[model samples]
Target: MTKLTLGVSSCLLGDEVRFNGGHKHHRWLTHTFGQYADFVPYCPEVAIGMGIPRNPIRLISTDTGTRAVDSMNLTDDYTERLQHYAESIVPQLDALDGYVVMQGSPSCGMERVKLYNKNMIPEKIAAGLYTGVLQRHAPAIPFEESGRLSDPNLVENFVQRVYVYHDWRTRQPWRTAKELIDFHARQKYLLMMHDYPTYKRLGQKLSNLKDIDNRGAFGQAYLVELMAALSNIPKRGHRVNVLQHVMGYFKNQLSEKEKASLIHSIEQYQASEVPFIVPVALLKHYIFLHGDQFPYLMNQTFLNPYPEELGLRNPI
Candidate 1:
């Protein structure tokens, strides 16, 4: 398997990269992704001669939200330094499949960062400096704030995105019918949540990939279509769609009573946004107890690490 690379703010790694020299140190990230992907930590502030344990930076907009901007040292020193550092490391951002940004730092916050008034009054608009840079430099790069990963669903979603992108990159050299089928299989549930027609259209385009002689051009075209199709944002109602698909994988192996229970659990989940893990765990338990029934799907990419990692095992 190709290794996934993810860029993360240095503060999240327990480094004293903040203006006040404090580290956020997200435990879940250090414990989980540290095992798989290679984490590249970056500290734009520290690189700017701002020195660790320095003065706190502030986000100030001279005008309104539309004109709200990041500035410091009259020249917007912090934003300028961060921009230069960010631009210099464009190659690193280009290499990464995703990034984990600090939630609300003037330099690293992903959203709703503090917007300060030039004087005593607080302003209405607050935008993160680092967030702006990352967005501009790598518009296509998927990123999420470190704090948001606590929601298992969001965690799984971002992970799936990274893996899907990685899969797309790794499979660039050749895309076979078997590979397409497998990719679609993992993406099926993720698809139903966003746009069904787009997914199918991309699938249809993939059918031609195997026949075309220009492998390189074909591969590039396929990536554009495939990424667009798979990038749909997951939403509510999709729980039912995902549940039904997951059930189909387990139905044959499960007893009628067990099936009813699992289905009921799914209903509760839809009404409640409870973790999907409850019904899924029950089904998985059945699979383990009754191993002979659905052997192939047990190892399917869709069934193995995804929903489970996303805490889809029980309810929410």
Candidate 2:
């Protein structure tokens, strides 16, 4: 598979783009996730003609409106510059599959950047100005903060979405109805794991894709809904449901003892006694032993969403 293109904060990759002339330098992102991604790093503060070691900026709220202003000098507003840069670059990043942003930044934070009042007292939290525009322009793209990537569950979900997005992009301009249907079929289990109801709804929508007057519009709407459904991390209940469904494929081939072992593994996973990998590994083993009998299961992306080396679902 081709490497996914990702929009990332420059500092996350060890670039000295911060106002203090120091980089945030997240090692995991640079040395690990970096292997799978072609990163396009941006620093709105520096890109807007601001110098390194420049005066800091913050989101300011007042009777007029909230503005990105210098922390020490409220009059030095860069709101328009940041917004312009964000809007201009999004169109150029049409092939980007995902984005990773710095947390708590005034111009790039995904969420909960501090907003201050006219008196310069911190008030509430809001998204960074540049990120807000990016989200608005490309709402379907998967986005995560570098700080949140430390959580295994969040990292797993983010990586899954990125791979799914990249796969969908690689097979574009779906001229034939069969191509889209096959794509949806391949992603069925993954969608069900995230959100069963949306999966059913999207399935119904895709059924009528051939009848729709504008295939492009229909495909875009489907993409939006699909990505939104995947935004939620799959709960343990969802995983249990998917595992049981997958096990159904081996009902005839498994002996009584093998069936019992698989059932026990599933139960152990449901009870939180083992990580998700234990049951998933067992299922893959059975599928490997009897893959010819169940070709559908072998082709499902849910079995191996991302590279195993990432160890995303290790249950730890």
Candidate 3:
């Protein structure tokens, strides 16, 4: 297994590194991920030499591109320095598989960041300082926000993307069309759950590529399409939908008595509004108490999303 090294905003880990010395610590993250991956904590404000409890900055739209201006004034542009520092540090962060940033911050928010006008008026232009640069530098990395992590779907997809990214990197000297095909197949269910049309279009793109003589160029194009194929899939809601279908497999395997207890809980899944893991866990407790009737429930879709061997229960 390729251990994913994830970078996160230091403030989101309850670190008192925010501009006002407050943190946006997400408990679900620090508790669950703290044990799984290597977290490289970063505070961009401090990294750019701005200390804690310093003046705040917001994104501004001048005649030029979006600029980071002092929230208190419209004259000063602090983003040139942030841009320079980002270009330098982005190269050194070559090993990260994913990043989780604090949303709505001018410096780190991934999207919908506040953009201001020259008149010091807030506009709806969404932009983030470090986020755009980091994404441009590492296009393949999985990135999301602290708030978005609460949705189990985004968490599952983020985890899958991180693992896949690491897996792609490990297949050094990626050779043969079959390798590309297998990777794409593995992502099939994820694509279906997210964007059905985009998923369909990506399949066409992959199928109709021009035959080139050079193998290296073809492989490079393959990798690009692999990322492009996944691009349309919205990372959040689709992931949850996939998880719920996977949970359904457990329901089908239950005995008459066990099924009776879980049928109502399982029915809630039809609305697709509640968390699948919640009801799935209830079913597991009801069945596992029997101790041997459905021992393989541990290996069921409710338990593992990605298995070494394909189970008919898996959605993809």
TM-score of each: 0.73, 0.96, 0.69
Q: Name the runs in model 1 displaced over 4 angstroms.
A: 1-4, 62-72, 115-127, 174-182, 194-197, 207-236, 246-265, 268-274, 282-300, 305-315
**Model 3 agreement with the true structure over 1-316: per-residue lDDT tens digits:** 5456888989988999988989988886777666567788888788888878887988987687888877777576778888877787686556776788998889888888878776767865574888888878766667888877766555665665666666665664546655555555556555665566665766676565444435466655655555554545354355455545544545565677766656655556545545555554665575566535544444332244432231212121
Best by lDDT: 2
Residue 296 error, candidate 2, Å: 2.2
lDDT of 2: 0.88
Clashes of 2: 0
Worst 10 residues of 3 by lDDT: 307-316
lDDT of 3: 0.66
Any runs in candidate 3 off by more than 4 Å, and if so which? 197-316
Tens-place lDDT per residue, model 1, 72-183, is 3444445566677767878676578788998877777777777766673554345467667777666556688888888766677677677777766556455555665566
lDDT of 3 at 305: 40
For model 2, residues 51-147, the per-residue Cα lDDT tens digits are 9999999998877776998988878999999999999888866779899999999899988889987667785488899999999988888999989
| TM-score: model 1 vs. ground truth | 0.73
Give me the candidate number with maximum TM-score: 2
**Candidate 2 clash pair list:** none
Order the candidates by TM-score, highest first: 2, 1, 3
Q: List per-prediction Cα lDDT, in the order shown.
A: 0.67, 0.88, 0.66
Clashes of 3: 0
